[model samples]
Target: MDEALWAVGRGTGVAALVLFTASVVLGIITRSGRPLPGLPRFSVTLVHRNVSLAASLFLVVHVVTLMFDPYALLNLLDVFVPFFGSYRPVWQGLGTVAFDLLIVIVVTSLLRNRLGPRVFKAIHWLTYAMWPIALAHAIGNGTNGVEGWFLVLSGVCVLAVLASFGWRLSSRFVEFRSVRLGEIS
Candidate 1:
C-alpha cells in the first residue's frame, strides 16, 4: 500500500509538471491570438483550457497521494500552506506556493464570466509565475531531478515557453513600433 501510494505520488508529480508545461506553452500560444499551424485560434484556445484543467487534476493527485503515503513528510498544512512542512521546507514550500497560485488561477478562470475580463485576465497571468515555481520545486525535490531524460524534458518545456513568450513580446513590440511610425493606422 505504501509503495503503491508512493509510486502514484511520484508518477503524478511528473505528469503534473509535464501537463503544466503544456498548459503554459499552449496558453502563451493562445494568448498571441495566432492560430496554431493548421488549426483555428478557437481550437488552440480550447485545447489550452482543457490542458490546464487536466494539469490541475494531476497536481491534485500528486498532492493527495503524497499526503496519504506514510513516508512522505507532508501534513495538510504543508500541502496547503507554504513553508509549513517539517520536511525539506524550501522545496516543499515552492510546491505549496505553486498550488496556491494554480488554485487562484483556476478558480478565477472558472468565474471569468461573472468576474469580468479584467479580473480574469489579472489572475490568469499568474500562470507565468506558477509554472516556474512548480518547475523549481520539481527540480529541487524530485528524486530523478538529475536524471538525463528528466533534464531533457525540463529543457524542452523551458524552451517552448520561452520561444512562445519571445514571439508574443516581439510581435507586440513590432506592432507598437509600427503604430508609432504611422505604418499602421
Candidate 2:
C-alpha cells in the first residue's frame, strides 16, 4: 500500500507537470494569435482550459496521495501553508505558494464575467509566475530529480516554454513595428 501510494503520487505529479507545460505553451500560442492547423482560436482557449483542469486534478491527486503516504510526513497545514513542512521545507513551500496562486487564477477565471475583464486578465497572467515556481518546486523536490531521464524531461519542458516566449516576443515586436509604420491600425 505504501509503495502504491508513493508511485501514484510520483506519477500524478509528473503527469500534472507535463500537462501544465502543454497548457503554458498553448496559452502562449493562443496569445500570439497564430491559428493552429484545423484549430480555431477559441478551440485553442478551450483546449488550454481543459488541459489546465486535468493538470489541476492530477496535482490534487499528487498532493492527496503524498499526504496519505507515511514517508512524506506532511500535514494539512503543510499542504496549504508555506515553509512549515518537516520535509524539504523550501521546495515544499514553493509548491504551496504555487498552489495558492493556482487557486487565485482558477477562481478568478470561473468568476471572470462577474469580475470583468481587467481583473480576470490580471489574475490569469499569474500563470507565467506559477509555471516557473512549479518547475522549481518539482526540480527541487522530485524523487527522481537527479535521474537522467527526469533532467531531460525537465529540459524539454523548459525549452517548450522558452520557445513560446521567444515567439510571442517577436510577434509582439512585429506588431508594434507594423503599428509604427501604419501597416496596421
lDDT of each candidate versus the true structure = 0.85, 0.87
Best by lDDT: 2
Predicted model with the maximum TM-score:
2
Candidate 2: give the clashing pairs.
none
Supply every candidate's count of residue pairs whose N, Cα or C atoms clash at under 3 angstroms. Answer: 0, 0
Model 1: lDDT equals 0.85
- Alpha carbon lDDT of residue 20, candidate 1? 91
CA shift at 44, candidate 1, in angstroms?
0.8
Model 1 root-mean-square deviation: 3.5
Count steric clashes of candidate 2: 0
TM-score of each candidate? 0.90, 0.91
